[model samples]
Target: MAKVSIVDVAKAAEVSVSTVSLVLRKKGHISQATTDRVHQAMAELGYVYNQSAANLRSQKSNVIGLLFDRLESDFSIKILKCLIRELEKQGFIAMVKTGALTADALTLAVNELKTQHVAGIILVAAGSVDGGLTPVLSAAELPYQVMANQGGLGMSDLIVCDHYSDSLTLTRFLLDLGHVSTVLFGGELHDPVFGERANGYLEAYRERGIPARKAHIIYADTDLTGQRQRLEAALRSDNSISALLCHSPAAAMIGAQSVLKLGYGVGKDFILSQQKYVTCFQEVDRLSDGVMDLSYILLPLEEMAHHAVRQLLQRLDTPEPLPGRAFSGALIR
Candidate 1:
């Protein structure tokens, strides 16, 4: 038995193979009568239009997969909400998945999403630029964007915070408060984002002519639990430190709790501030020294979603596809 393909359908309907493909793909370029005729011919010939095959050919999946590293982090939740609202504004729905912090986990998760035929993917590759998406995303044959922490690989487009200038501004804010001896409780400097923040902190120290003190700089984890140990160790190791520069609000909270738990007040015992992606003001109930804004970079989630949609539309237009476009974030603080 001969397999009924697009050519057979076109011959049966007295139309071009392109027309049959369009009809099967529901591109809506053909007229109603022609569409009905092609469908009728397809029914008569007992032809089953392979939807997956057609989708592969056209590369038009109206779905955008939103992936995050971890869901427990407040920053992740806030970004996800912002991204969701932005995607909805662009007339697109987001199917979100999380807990894929590792490279292997992300690869498997993205592969599973690919099976569902997503138009594209948007990922917040937090804590690490290598989200284990390189292999799968490269082979995906779809438009994808990564909101990164700088120096990310395989990001068709990247949206990152301006850590250098923002962090400098925040660190100087602590310096300006007459707090000569300060502690920098931050994440690992290996991370691009945190590395930038570290640069800013170092620049402030250089400008203030303060020698880099190893004990005053704490490489605390971004999460609260890990930070508790690091902050305690830092405070115990350094008695001259009277101020703190945290990386994120979560880090700031950990520092604050540690300051209080150590029988010291936030503003009186030690001054503090942090860098934020959206707005750190809302995250904290009170704002004192460590609450200065290092400028917020609003992620272009809506624009990214629109770009993915436009790419899908273009792929549906011609055999040759247009290249993906990258968009940058804005400093709103």
Candidate 2:
């Protein structure tokens, strides 16, 4: 059988060849209904678009680059999956590159992506290394957007969950529940992501005219044993601390375990609250049965990824600067 061609798709869809070409290239002001018809015709005819040939003809690539500091965590994996799916739906292919979170490594990755002729890039900075990476990305002068927990120093468009609002809401909820001495657990002091959350936690106390204790803010250690030790010490130091507000699900699990090890019931003796990514709830559930008893702020990772892809595509189409997008997490008690 002859390979299906654009002419055949045009004939089947009852549109001109040029219209089919426009639809294939995602150009022109084609109506949604017409686009759907063209897609259906191509599907029925088993048409496979030759992206390489199209790129050569038009001098515009349909490949997007995804640069990541790391992809080790479940949150990163979920974001990766969402980004791939969304990019594919927009008629673009993804080229993923991961490396050490440093200026030199990021420069190498961006240069490599440029050599491949990627249309644009989406940088995923999970760690607090964006301070160094932002300068490299800006120097590259490529069309790129950032999808991370914290915004970088550059003027690039960003997509991030509203950590400050969510943290403030969660902390206030715990305080309203009569846990005035609730302690915040996890996160580094210098990291921007954690800094926003810490400010929110403190803001909640300020709103209520309650003085926040310096000792109540506990930064997480690299290991679980160290975190457990710190939490145990905090609880022992103040009998009035009847609640724990953790920065993430992992922190919450450790806090719960520590409370139990100290002969305190999780729900009865001490309240547990945490900010959880919606996508990774199942993993957390399997890791700790006590998670169900805790109050939560749910981060919508899929929604954030969808917005990031949409914004990046828009940025590619029109080289104008777009405002950064921030989404708030949902509260669950």
How large is the C-alpha RMSD of every model relative to the true structure?
11.8, 7.0
Which digits, one per residue and each the tens of the lDDT, describe model 1 over residues 59-137?
5455678888777754566667777776665446688888565667877778878888887777775545663555666
Off by over 4 Å in 1: 1-61, 99-111, 131-135, 153-156, 186-195, 221-241, 257-265, 268-282, 286-333
- Model 2 clash pairs? none
The Cα local distance difference test for each model comes to 0.62, 0.74
In terms of lDDT, model 1 sits at: 0.62
**TM-score between candidate 2 and the true structure:** 0.73
Per-residue lDDT tens digits for candidate 2, residues 117-199, read 88778988774335456678767766677887665565446677677888888877877777778678877667667788888
Candidate 2 positional error at 43, Å: 22
The TM-scores of all predictions, comma-separated, are 0.56, 0.73
For residue 108, give model 2's deviation from the true position in Å.
2.6
Best by TM-score: 2
